[model samples]
Target: MKIYVMVDIEGISGVYCSEQVTPASGRFAEGRKYMTEDINACVAGLRDAGVDEIIVHDCHGGSYSLNWADVSPEADGYICGTIGDSRYVDIDDCDGLILLGYHAMAGTAGAVLEHTYSSKRIQNMYINDVLVGETAVDAAIAGEHGVPVIMVSGDDKLCAEAKRFLPDVVTAQVKKGLSTQGAVLLPPEKAHRLIHDKAMEAVKKLPLIKPYVIPAPITHKIELMERCQLPNAAGKPYMNVIDGRAYSVAADSVEEARMRSGG
Candidate 1:
């Protein structure tokens, strides 16, 4: 009955401006508050759903985006700070994973704050030739460990992306993205309520959900935004430099491929 929750800031309700998610910006704290409340709503729902243990992870850049003090007391534990590449830590032991405040992949039309893993470095990412976002990446990691992603929350595009990647996943769409920095938002209270309801619904439907497995021998490909971002691995055995701005890594598992790619 344990569940893991991964929280990001870009897609939270009322968060539309890029400065709101930038740690150096004066508006960053406001975004953190919104993220914390959204997670609390999900936490409350999970608790009501009879989940025994809940763990929340700050998945945003630097992992300092969560207002931990404002998070629900019901959550059993929290993981924050520089967690490095071991993003799937302890996910194998959880019954389900929930993605909160996630957004769409890079180049997604009308997706708010749209970008893949790194907005500055990565222009695009694909697994088995299918373009994906953080949602699919996390889902594959969980799937590698036999954990199903049961719920996701974000803007309309993100929710739709979740459904396309993870079957039977329940989603809470808090806003409708009009552009990269703009969205038609739901009132905070309404968004939180929807999250609460969807969280419970996701857990309730868990029995019908399945792990989203991207078959073995995964080919992790990355398209860098700038040619200079490509690492100098001219003769590396593990990597195949596609071009000046692209590279590919091959591995038997999704996690291994991601780790090797430094994703």
Candidate 2:
């Protein structure tokens, strides 16, 4: 079966500092390696579970953190860049989705790197009136095509949040949030073991977990940091300026919402 993997950095094992998440920062190289290791572990686990084809999307900052060449050649995958590609989790064609290194929603308590899109620009984000993070949005998109989010790995807070959103999916808590920009990390080896085990288990129980779908008439609300940027950013038709910092959009589906957000 084909499994789609979406990898983010904030929730990766041993990642507890903002310096690790940014490319300009010195620790970013190590963070990138750590992220890749987690993805590889998931791939290895899925392969062990008899999954033949896997497509991985590097969905972190600018969407180009993971080194595509470094990914295991055994399971060929694609890397999603910042230019806005259409190949993100084609749920209609995939058997399951694995959200790796996901984080909590914006403004959540005890969440590491608690921000939707940008810690500075985006104060909050809502999909179908439910406040959600990137993980939630990706899950909703996967659900639109009847693909179950079989597994998710991130911080403890994010794992708990994922359970609330995808109750039946398997989750691996690689770290615990000590602050918005810091966390208590689990060793890389331990994190990989947990991810591998959980991923394998998720595949076995994939049929038990239901796809998470946002009801029809999807609504999006983005709370921007700059009030002036709001009007210029979301000037598309059907997008209403809720206030200086908030803008709302009504769409028929997640795809429409994504387009509205310039995704």
TM-score per model over all chains: 0.98, 0.94
lDDT of 2 by residue, 90-184 (tens): 55888899999888888889899877867777888888778888778888878888887999998989989888878888999998898887778
- Candidate 1 positional error at 143, Å: 0.3
lDDT of 1 by residue, 1-263 (tens): 99999989998988998999999999999999999999999999999999999999988998888887788999999899987678856787899999999999999899999998789999899999999899999899898899999999888999899888885899899999999999999988999999999999999999889998999889999999888888766666778999999999988988998888975
Residue 221 shift from truth in candidate 2, angstroms: 1.1
Model 1 CA deviation exceeding 4 Å by range? none
TM-score of candidate 1 against the unseen true structure: 0.98
| Candidate 1 global CA lDDT score | 0.90
Query: Which candidate has the highest TM-score of all?
Result: 1
